[model samples]
Target: MSDQLFGSWMDKRDSNWVVFAYFDWIYSSGMFIQMLECLSKRWGFGTDDVDCRFPDNNSFDVDDHFSGVEFSYGLMYDPDVVIVSDEEFGRYLDMACFKYIERTPGSAEYVRSMLSRNEPGNG
Candidate 1:
């Protein structure tokens, strides 16, 4: 990936999930896992390649150039879960997580393995 994309990925990975009062998607942890699976398929990553950021109030923007959109959270949230309406947003999330994991020295090995597998799932 290009340095700009890599930097964007890293920024989003470090951002915390915003809890919004307006959205109550009622998603379980299983939803997160399923989302990961879906993202792996769309982004050509792997099932175990994605990671989740802990919930916090920090503001950040996840820019997805592929879909020509940007996902912003935190400022819009109000202590509940922020419901993302777009499915393509998940791919950006996965990319961010993958980038974060891959940058962690020894952790890059796992990312390399996952990317090399090239197994596609339902995005």
Candidate 2:
């Protein structure tokens, strides 16, 4: 969950943090779908807002022979506002990784830490 985990896929736009997490061929499409579901639930937005695409037979082939999955979400919560605090945003990422992704222990912590560091002006 370090900045390197996302590499060049992280950006900011209009006061929103756009984060992209990609899974290589080793992971299933179901995993990506589950991540979308988790994000929808956390943001109170529908999956319709998410855009997911996977490689197909007609798509260009790579050496890995694995179709990658990309999950992107825009974090629009204002941490300085009373409605949403920085801790809440961090907790959302933690819960998404823990409950939805079912990642191992400490995984959520790593995500939270990285996200905290990536916040605007935090770098």
Candidate 3:
């Protein structure tokens, strides 16, 4: 999008089974498709959208700002052969951010940036 499509996180382990997507408008179908192909291989997917996610906290509170990534197989109700706990999602999210956003990008600043906009009076 705006040269920045990211998933924010303080730590890799901050969210397993979630991708806290932070993006900017500038959708390019070609770029998006290509990214999926490249990212899929890295994420153990032969062909599918890697809409990963990271829970901001242990409470598993879903952020209202973004819906995060969607899985091709379906929502992750239980970890399976596709994904085991530990380092699975963090690595994927990191890979996506690196490829789409920037090298070593993604941090609390991105998340906080959204929180600031989610004001009490501002719809």
Candidate 4:
């Protein structure tokens, strides 16, 4: 996406590129459990105790509500790498990250254009 478009996108959300980058890193690494925990803690769910099931310290048993919002954490000031093992889940996490990026303001068209450029057949 163009820098102008990306800038406009950033303007509309209470988010930073660093947070998005962390989302990318954690999802790619397959440490989605830690990602969710960090996000839940950030989102004030720390006191609620969601039934988060961490399988093998890598993946998290995230329900529908927790699937795609990890990029919005307010506490994680830095990014960390996660170790991934499942290819399909990894792809799913990657797609979810793209979706999060697309959901940001001024980013849908840019993201859509990117997807089309990357996979014309799928587009």
Q: lDDT at 120 for candidate 1?
A: 42
Residue-level lDDT tens digits of model 3 in 20-59: 2211111122344333333333322222333333223344
- C-alpha TM-score for every candidate: 0.27, 0.24, 0.24, 0.24
Candidate order, TM-score descending: 1, 3, 4, 2
TM-score of 1: 0.27
Question: Which residue pairs clash in candidate 2?
Answer: none
Question: What lDDT would each prediction earn against the true structure?
Answer: 0.33, 0.35, 0.34, 0.36
Clashes per model (N, Cα, C within 3 A): 2, 0, 6, 2
Residue by residue across 5-43, what tens digits does model 2's lDDT show?
Answer: 223433444232332223221122334334434433332
- Give the per-residue lDDT digits (tens) of candidate 4, residues 1-123: 332212322233433443344444444444444444343232221111111111332336333233322323223444322223233233434464365465454655544443343232431
- Which sections of candidate 3 miss by over 4 Å? 1-71, 74-81, 103-123
Which has the higher lDDT value, candidate number 3 or candidate number 4?
4
lDDT of 4 at 2: 30
Write down the RMSD of candidate 2 (Cα, Å). Answer: 15.5
lDDT of 4: 0.36
lDDT of 1 by residue, 92-119 (tens): 4545446445444565665444443333
